[model samples]
Target: MMILVTGGARSGKSRHAEALIGDSSQVSVYRYLANP
Candidate 1:
Protein backbone atom coordinates (compact mmCIF):
# COMPACT_ATOMS: atom_id res chain seq x y z
CA MET A 1 0.00 0.00 0.00
CA MET A 2 1.16 3.52 -0.78
CA ILE A 3 0.64 6.29 1.74
CA LEU A 4 1.28 9.80 0.53
CA VAL A 5 1.91 12.27 3.32
CA THR A 6 2.30 15.98 2.76
CA GLY A 7 3.34 18.60 5.29
CA GLY A 8 5.60 21.57 5.98
CA ALA A 9 9.18 21.25 7.22
CA ARG A 10 9.59 19.67 10.70
CA SER A 11 5.93 18.64 10.65
CA GLY A 12 6.68 15.17 12.02
CA LYS A 13 6.47 13.62 8.59
CA SER A 14 9.30 11.13 9.20
CA ARG A 15 8.09 10.28 12.67
CA HIS A 16 4.60 9.73 11.35
CA ALA A 17 5.93 7.56 8.56
CA GLU A 18 7.83 5.47 11.08
CA ALA A 19 4.63 5.04 13.08
CA LEU A 20 2.89 3.69 10.01
CA ILE A 21 5.44 0.91 9.82
CA GLY A 22 5.03 -2.29 11.83
CA ASP A 23 8.27 -2.97 13.74
CA SER A 24 12.08 -2.78 13.71
CA SER A 25 12.76 -5.04 10.72
CA GLN A 26 9.96 -3.38 8.80
CA VAL A 27 11.32 0.00 9.85
CA SER A 28 14.70 -0.48 8.12
CA VAL A 29 13.02 -1.36 4.85
CA TYR A 30 10.28 1.25 5.02
CA ARG A 31 12.65 3.95 6.21
CA TYR A 32 14.71 3.38 3.06
CA LEU A 33 11.68 3.96 0.87
CA ALA A 34 10.33 6.74 3.05
CA ASN A 35 13.54 8.72 2.85
CA PRO A 36 14.45 7.81 -0.69
Candidate 2:
Protein backbone atom coordinates (compact mmCIF):
# COMPACT_ATOMS: atom_id res chain seq x y z
CA MET A 1 0.00 0.00 0.00
CA MET A 2 1.03 3.58 -0.64
CA ILE A 3 -0.05 6.92 0.74
CA LEU A 4 0.80 10.42 -0.44
CA VAL A 5 0.31 13.49 1.68
CA THR A 6 0.53 16.97 0.22
CA GLY A 7 -0.21 20.34 1.72
CA GLY A 8 1.20 23.78 2.43
CA ALA A 9 4.39 24.19 4.47
CA ARG A 10 4.19 23.37 8.21
CA SER A 11 0.62 22.15 7.82
CA GLY A 12 1.19 18.93 9.83
CA LYS A 13 1.22 16.76 6.76
CA SER A 14 4.03 14.57 8.03
CA ARG A 15 2.51 14.28 11.46
CA HIS A 16 -0.85 13.29 10.03
CA ALA A 17 0.74 10.74 7.76
CA GLU A 18 2.72 9.24 10.61
CA ALA A 19 -0.39 8.93 12.69
CA LEU A 20 -2.21 7.07 9.96
CA ILE A 21 0.67 4.66 9.53
CA GLY A 22 1.04 4.16 13.24
CA ASP A 23 -2.64 3.26 13.53
CA SER A 24 -2.42 0.66 10.82
CA SER A 25 -2.03 -3.03 11.59
CA GLN A 26 -0.50 -4.16 8.26
CA VAL A 27 2.25 -1.62 7.86
CA SER A 28 5.70 -3.01 8.53
CA VAL A 29 8.10 -0.52 6.95
CA TYR A 30 8.12 3.16 6.12
CA ARG A 31 10.17 5.05 3.57
CA TYR A 32 10.23 8.80 3.47
CA LEU A 33 10.71 10.61 0.20
CA ALA A 34 11.45 14.30 0.39
CA ASN A 35 12.42 16.77 -2.30
CA PRO A 36 13.52 20.25 -1.51
Best by lDDT: 2
Worst 10 residues of 2 by lDDT: 27-36
- List CA RMSD, all candidates: 4.9, 1.9
TM-score of model 1 vs. true structure: 0.55
| Residue pairs in collision within model 2 | none
Error of 2 at 9 (Å): 0.4
TM-score of 2: 0.65
Worst 10 residues of 1 by lDDT: 26-35
Model 1 / residue 25 / CA error / Å: 9.8
Clashes of 2: 0
Q: How accurate locally, in lDDT, is each candidate?
A: 0.63, 0.79
Kindly list the per-residue Cα lDDT of model 1 for residues 1-36, writing each as its tens digit: 566767877888778877777544432445433344
The list of candidate 2 runs beyond 4 A from truth reads: 33-36
